[model samples]
Target chain A: MFDDRSPIYQQIANGIKDEVLSGTLKEDEQIMSTNQYAAFYRINPATAAKGFAQLVDEGVLYKKRGIGMFVSPDARGRLRAQRRERFFADVVDPMLTEARMVGVGVDEIVAYLKDGAR
Target chain B: MISLRDLTVRYGDTVAVDGITLDLEPNKIYGLLGRNGSGKTSLLSVLASYRRPCAGTVTIDGVDPFENAALMRATAFVRDSLDVTDQDRIAKVLDFAGRLRPTWDAGYAEHLADVFELDRRRRVSALSRGQRSSLGVVLGLAARAPLTILDEVYLGMDAGARAAFYRELLADYLAHPRTIILSTHLIEEVAGLFEQVIVIDRGRLLLHEDTDTFRARGVAVTGPAAAVEAFAAGRTVLGEQSLGGVRQVTLYGALADHEAEAARTAGLTLAPVGVQDLFVHLTAVGDTARTEALR
Candidate 1:
């Protein structure tokens, strides 16, 4: 199911990226056709197609003429690399900001993380 | 393409659909929304050529649809009121549509009947409201007309049945592309299916744009009353509510990326309003439309 947080097509594109990251959709694996995707998600075919188009543009997926879309051979690695690059800014920075706002010291946070690792 | 030139429809002293001009492209699903007595049905009736407009024109593929046998054959308008006899069976009703519709697919009709679990031998009079609605869905989808309009045919269907209908409709539409217009009050349920949406209020065109744009045009900013008011100042406030110093104001415009970031920093929650909430605020009684009219 989709939410109104962002455009449905963007959500669809992100969903495919997540699948690639999670290894649920293997590299070079044939993915659902836009029509099938649209029906499965109960969204407009055009919207689903737009999402696939976005993935293709991002080099995350490739299309086989007269066939369907497949995950790019480097899709998983590429996604992981991209997420890694943004991890500090998108994930870590936000957490640090929230922690600072709550007056949680970095030392205490590190201790808790080390304890959880045990 | 279908074009409407200053179309107007009247019944006695009641002006159902006031003068309105618009164009609807082919092979796209359009969601039409309007409040009760806001001329949604009358406008659809004219577009479907079920009734002649008192003034102006409606052209289908650059030709008049009224009394044009060729054009009529290519258009299917199915509403909740089943056009079959109460004493007749469901099979009889579908047979009549198949004979009349030039593009009718009997196989698909039968398939849809199975999907809806419709009893073909059951009399129309004995069918429940939901069953009758299912029959309407069969007729509309199986007709496969170039111009198919379904006017709230899911009136009596349960949530599961409605979900099935949406699935069937999207699948069939992908298989056979055509111009389809759906008029419904279930904005949240099916808004995603529409490529474009047309909203009318008080017999006037309120808005017609891509569904995505229509939804993105509004944002709900919620926070402390003073900050919310400051953020909403100089913006079109479509609706607002306040509870215990927390205020939420729905603004009718886009929120730029920087502005959204600023709002976040300012501790304001900038949320996107769903199509249904937007529609309610757009056409609710004594809402923006009435205020505009009064001004």
Candidate 2:
């Protein structure tokens, strides 16, 4: 099921990326065709196709002439690299901002992280 | 493509469709949305060639559709009512449609009947409201017309039946692509099935755009009253609510990346508004008054 908070196509693309990153979808693994995805999700085929097209544009998936879409060989690695690039700004920075607002010092956050590591 | 130019429909002294012009591409599902008395049915009737527009013109692939036998055969307009003789059995009605519709697939119709659990022996007058609706679904989907318009064909179906209808519709559409226009009051339930959304209000075209674009147009910003208010200051606020120190303002525009970042940095949480919620806000009584005033 998809939430309405963002474009469904974006969500679809993110979902496939997550699968690829988690190794659930291996390199060259053929995924559901856009029509199959549409029927499975009870969505318009055009919307589902748009999501698949976005993934292809980002090099996360590849087309196979007349067959179907397959996961790119470097999809997981590229996705991981992309996430790493945004980790601090998208995740840690927001967390640190919240921490600052709550009057928690950076040392306290560092100590908590150290404790969790153990 | 289907084109309508300044189309108008009137019944007696009342103008049902007023100078509405729109272009719909082929082979896409369009959600036709409108409040009660918004002329959605009137517009669809004209498109289906059930009636002529009082003014202006309607063309399908560069040909006038009104009373054009070939075009009529290519279009299927299934109304909320079954539009069959009460004395006829369900099987007989479908047989009639198959004889008239060049694209009608008897096998698909039978399959859809089974999916909807329709009894072929039942007379039209004997069927329940839900059963009648299911029959309409069978007719609309099985016809496989290039242009299929269903006008709130889910009027009395229960939740399970409606779910089945949606699933079957998507599956069949995938297998055999065609142009579909569904007019429904159940916006949230069927919004996902639409590639494009057309909204009409008070016999006027309100908006027509890709469904995703329409979905992204409304954003709800929630936070402290001051922060929320500040973020919504120059925006078109669709609706708002406040509880204790928290305020949520629903805005009618897509927020730019930096603007969304600014809201988040100001501690405001941005949420996407559902299509139903956006439609409600856009067609709300007060908003309609404001729209009329602006015009």
Candidate 3:
């Protein structure tokens, strides 16, 4: 859920992203309030709010003034797009680095990713 | 800026701050968070010019706070106790502050008194512990010092009051930015208010980092003991607990997506580590290690 090297808000953002991507969350669905998330997770509401705000900023969520944060209509797509953009930088680089160390070439790495996708 | 170089304080047999060096800048609200007996009060005392650091140098804007009248005048230190004599009435203390603090706004202080329903003529000695805490908060805010240090000033306040205080503190800080160092045990509650945070554990600096950077630093993994151990190999495991094959470990590092995926593939459940839990893991490990971390 968290690490000494990643911001808490980012972890929260990732958690919410998981829900959205998994279809547990829905388009235009009102997500839990900051206080609700905070109480449920036993974290500071501010921390939760920051996470929600980050999602809002990224267009994965939107605020309904005085109501609560709601998953955007295109939330899943938005997150998928953002994550896809960073996938290579975040995922592929390390994979390639690790693969190269083990004498696994680009073709083998590509084959493994293809297998995983299937 | 507030600077403490090799600061040390001793009270009888107790050594408070032991060779600490910290440079804190202005215009940011910092949470000077630590456990009890961590010398937070003593460090703030020296910074606020309320007490002299036994050894080392403490300077605010190039002036040693100890007995430095002008520097002390610009600083406000609010502890549960601010050395206000029991003989004085709460009103007198407010009145004294109103006169003494160059930035003191009497109207605002009176307004705070009204908000807290603090009776002016009531003796400070007769006040309840809760009320005393309220008074301390009142004085701290009303003083309006450039460097305002609140040392456990939220102790006696109820939940609602504490929430109100946080909101007002934030609002006030937003409106009139100043250097505020809040020393408290409520890490999660007030962690948001901090731009930069310094955690002193048992008279040592365990952590001093931007709130974002600090939060960016650790994670917990739960899984079978073998896989968990394997995943945690070459990583700093802050804490580990195992029951039969079920293992839970808190690791210190920036967890990347591949790392999380790796942990998942290795049959581990990734979880976020709480700052309080991290502090416990880091400090409870031992005095020697933590002390070295502080220096």
- Best lDDT among the predictions, by candidate number: 2
Give one digit per residue, the lDDT tens place, for model 3 in B90-131.
989998888777899788788777777789999999988778
For residue B5, give model 2's deviation from the true position in Å.
0.8
Error of 1 at B51 (Å): 1.1
Task: Using lDDT, rank the candidates from best to worst.
Answer: 2, 1, 3
Per-model TM-score of chain A alone? 0.95, 0.95, 0.83
Steric clash pairs (candidate 1): none
Report the poorest 10 consecutive residues by lDDT, candidate 1 chain B: B286-295
After superposition on all C-alphas, the RMSD of every candidate to the true structure, in Å, is 2.2, 2.0, 9.0
Off by over 4 Å in 3: A1-118, B285-287, B290-295
Name the regions of candidate 2 deviating beyond 4 angstroms. A103-108, B223-234, B243-247, B265-267, B292-295
* Every model's TM-score on chain B: 0.94, 0.94, 0.92
| Better by DockQ, candidate 2 or 1 | 2
lDDT of 2 by residue, B1-295 (tens): 9999999999999999999999999999999999888999999999998899999999998999888998998889999876899999999999999998889999999999998899999999999999999999999999999899999999889999999999988888888899999998788888889999998888999889988899898988899999998888867777899999999988987888999989989999988898889988888874666446323
Task: Point to the candidate with the largest TM-score.
Answer: 2
If both were scored by DockQ, which would come out higher, candidate 1 or candidate 3? Answer: 1
Q: Is the docking of candidate 1 incorrect, acceptable, medium or high quality?
A: medium
Q: Per-candidate TM vs. native?
A: 0.94, 0.94, 0.73
Clashing pairs in 2: none
Assess each prediction's global lDDT (C-alpha) against the native.
0.89, 0.91, 0.79
lDDT of 1 by residue, B1-295 (tens): 9999989999999988888888999999999998777888899999888899999999987999999999888889987787779998988998988887779999999999999999899999998899889999999999999999998899889998998999999999999989999998888899889989998887878788888778787799999999998888887788999999999998887888898988988899988888888888888786655436422
